[model samples]
Target: MKFAAFSGVFIAHSIQEAMKLTQKLGMDGIEIAAREPHLSPTTSAPRIKGIKALAADLGLEIPVLAGYMGGFSTASDQECEQAFDDFNRLLDMGGELGSSMIRVAPGGPNAFLAHDYHYAKAAHWLNKCAEAAQEYQIKLVLEIHNQSLVETVDSSLKLLHLIEHDHVGMIHDAGNMYITETDYGRDSIVNLGKHLFHVHVKDEIRVAEVGAPGTFLNLTHRGEEGFLQSRLGEGAADHQPMFDALKEVGYNGWITLECHAPYPAYERLAHDFQIVKKMLSWEHA
Candidate 1:
């Protein structure tokens, strides 16, 4: 396994700056955000190539395209067609940047409506997207996020099973599954162990008075209500066990550090990278 960081946390800076920061933090690779203020394949080809060249010059690899943002759940026919066009464009960009995987989300208001509806939409589009990805030798890893249709482990696994394609996989994010009421954390890795193509390490804390529903907070806020980002080893997530589980299952993909740690983004990201490296028993590769 290798270490990488998401560029979105550092979106306030330029893509080059973000990449340089990741390299300076002693990370092995980077997951570039494919959105505005970053490198969107739709509008920036020359810039994308330049960024790819810069990473290669620094002896760093672009393991995944982290910002292929678009949703197709409620999109009209034209919107859906545009989504496919965008998907193909990103696959081309992934090839140009030497990345074999692209991260996407299940977009649509319906995602929040019902499980069966969301899962069906996701399966249909993912399969169609996977067909395009297969042509470019790129895998589309659907990220398990809090707002999307496949927010939980079981849902994500079911979606993957429905897609039923080798070019489609899952991204297990610790923070997204951090809830006080359930043990979805352990089940996430265990159930989708085989289809995990990428990993996002984040932590959250749930705080509430006894007998009350605890408010989830990320490590960054520490004291805020609801979930907030946190530094590694300081939040509710026990990442060491998760790392061990990944190792047990022989997961060799890139483990990208998503530094949602608030305040002093650079320093916090550096610290998070080091913590994850130690937990994964990672050395400079």
Candidate 2:
């Protein structure tokens, strides 16, 4: 698996500076967040070209352009239509940035959002995205995230199988289990199988002692975001089994670090970079 870092974690750093840091740290690639202060859909054409040039200059591949296309599944028809339009803009951005895989969410509203109709609507949106992305040669990677219609292996596959579009794929996020309490089934990687197009790696432990499900998901601060802490083997998420499952499936793809490591982003990001590199090596060895 190729090692890439998501630029979102370095929110304080400029996209160019973050790419410099990523390259200096010896990462193979980066998953550029197609958001503000990064490479939003509204980013200028020259800036997009500069980004592609920068990646090439640093020998870093931009595999995934992760975006926040949330709440489409459970939204009204108008909202879903707007979400699809937003996804098209992201796909256009991805094409300009020289990246093919763009990350999106099968967002749903409210708890108990899981339903056949929800799955079908989400699939319809994906199909629209796939149809639109064909011109850009981009693939819309649906991430396993909470409040999403296809938030688990079972739910995700149930939705994807209905689309029959190759441009629609999956991203397995192990850290997501902290939110989706029942996300892990018998064998997630085995279940994901061929359709597993990408992966996001992050380690998180419970913030509160004996925390309930979705307990750690709450923010301690305004922009606290996700993850209490992150280290490879020492964290709450068990990655070895996940990697072993990848091996079993012969899956060789981009395993990105959506870095959420604490203060001194450089230190934590650099440390986890090596940790993931070692993890991938050991897994393949």
Candidate 3:
């Protein structure tokens, strides 16, 4: 498998600067984030063309588009239509940039009524999106995030089975699934092996109590406390086993480093990239 970097963690800088950093870090490619303060659908074609040209000039390829942030659950018909419009635009841009996969999180905080309802909604919308994506021959991979409906492996499998679309798959995020109280971490990957299209590598640690033995206080609200982000090999995530598992499954997809730690952007990303390179044994191509 190849190694890349997700630009989402580099939210502090412009996309152009992120591209430059990706090249400098000796990565094969990048996963662009198509959201505000990063990259948006409204970003002009010429600007995107400039990015493509730069990548080519630097011998880099964009294998994935990381941030298509519209969720289906809370969306009205109009909102869904707008999301569709935005998705199509992203697909067009990905085609222009020569990216084969696009990453999306199924639904955000407002999307889930309950687990089952969220799955049903996500399955329906993903199938529709998959049909739309087929026009450009792009694959839509859902990243497993906390607030997303497909947060666990079983849920992800259910959505995959329900959608039953070849273009739809999972993007396993090691850190996103790592909660202090639960073994949600490894299950997400183990359950969705063959269906995994991409991987986002990071680490997390929890220190607060949240009533349950394995449950951590929800850090988002002030009521919760004690959550920390660490570099690869520094936190709870045992990435080597994950790497070995991917190798066993013959997953030749991009393993992108997502440095969400609270360090300076450039330093953290560069360090994470090097650490991942060593773990993956990536060589110049």
Candidate 4:
């Protein structure tokens, strides 16, 4: 599997700076966060072209664009349309950026309020987006996140089944899955099978200790839990089993380092890269 650093972790840095830092950290690519202070819907073609050229020059791949577009579960049709419109723009940008995939949220009213109808609505809109994404030769991947309808593996598979498009798939966000206390590791990855389009690796721990520096609380459908983001392998979420499962599944897609631990972005990314390199048995030049 190839490795990448999520640019969302480098929000404080310029796009160029993020890209450079990613390359310097010995990553194979950079997953550009397609939002503010980075590349947004309003970002021009010239800027997109320049970003692509720079990535190429730096020997980096632009594997995926992490977009902030999603309202597929909202109560209004107009809101869904607007979200789709923004997603369409992101697809156009992805085409110019030469990215193969883009990350999408399933929908949110949180997991508790989201019902089967919300899931169906999200699938309908996602299928529509899949059609649009085909034009740009990009794959739309739904992130398995807690605040959304696709929080668990079963729910995510249900949405994928409803969408029924080969161009759409799932991002196995291990950290979020851990936070939600959902099924993960070999079982989840094997279940995802071909639908596991991409992966995000971060580490998290329960706030049993109470006084951790970066401790925060997350209230989800599964109830409330105090959590802290930690460096990979140093946290409660062990990724070795997940990596083994990816190998078993022959998943050669991008694995993005999306650590949100409170630390300097460069240092965090660099430290995480070493761990990932070891995990994947990847060697540098």
RMSD of each: 4.8, 4.4, 4.4, 2.0
* Each prediction's TM-score versus the true structure: 0.87, 0.87, 0.86, 0.94
Candidate 2 RMSD computed on C-alpha atoms after optimal superposition onto the true structure: 4.4
Question: Scored by CA lDDT, what does every candidate get?
Answer: 0.73, 0.74, 0.73, 0.85
Candidate 1, position 1, lDDT: 83
Candidate 4 accuracy as TM-score: 0.94
Clashing pairs in 2: none
Candidate 4 per-residue C-alpha lDDT over 9-52 given as tens digits, one digit per residue, 9 for 90 to 100: 99999999999999998889999998878788788889998999
Residue ranges of candidate 4 with Cα displaced over 4 Å: 109-113, 208-213, 282-285
TM-score of 2: 0.87
lDDT of 2 by residue, 154-196 (tens): 8777878888687788888887654555444328888787778
Model 1 weakest lDDT span, ten residues long: 214-223
> Which window of 10 residues has the lowest lDDT sum in candidate 3?
213-222
Runs in model 3 with CA error above 4 Å?
108-113, 180-190, 209-225, 281-285
Candidate ranking under lDDT, highest first, comes to 4, 2, 1, 3
Alpha carbon deviation, residue 242, candidate 2 (Å): 0.7
Which scores higher on TM-score, 1 or 2? 2
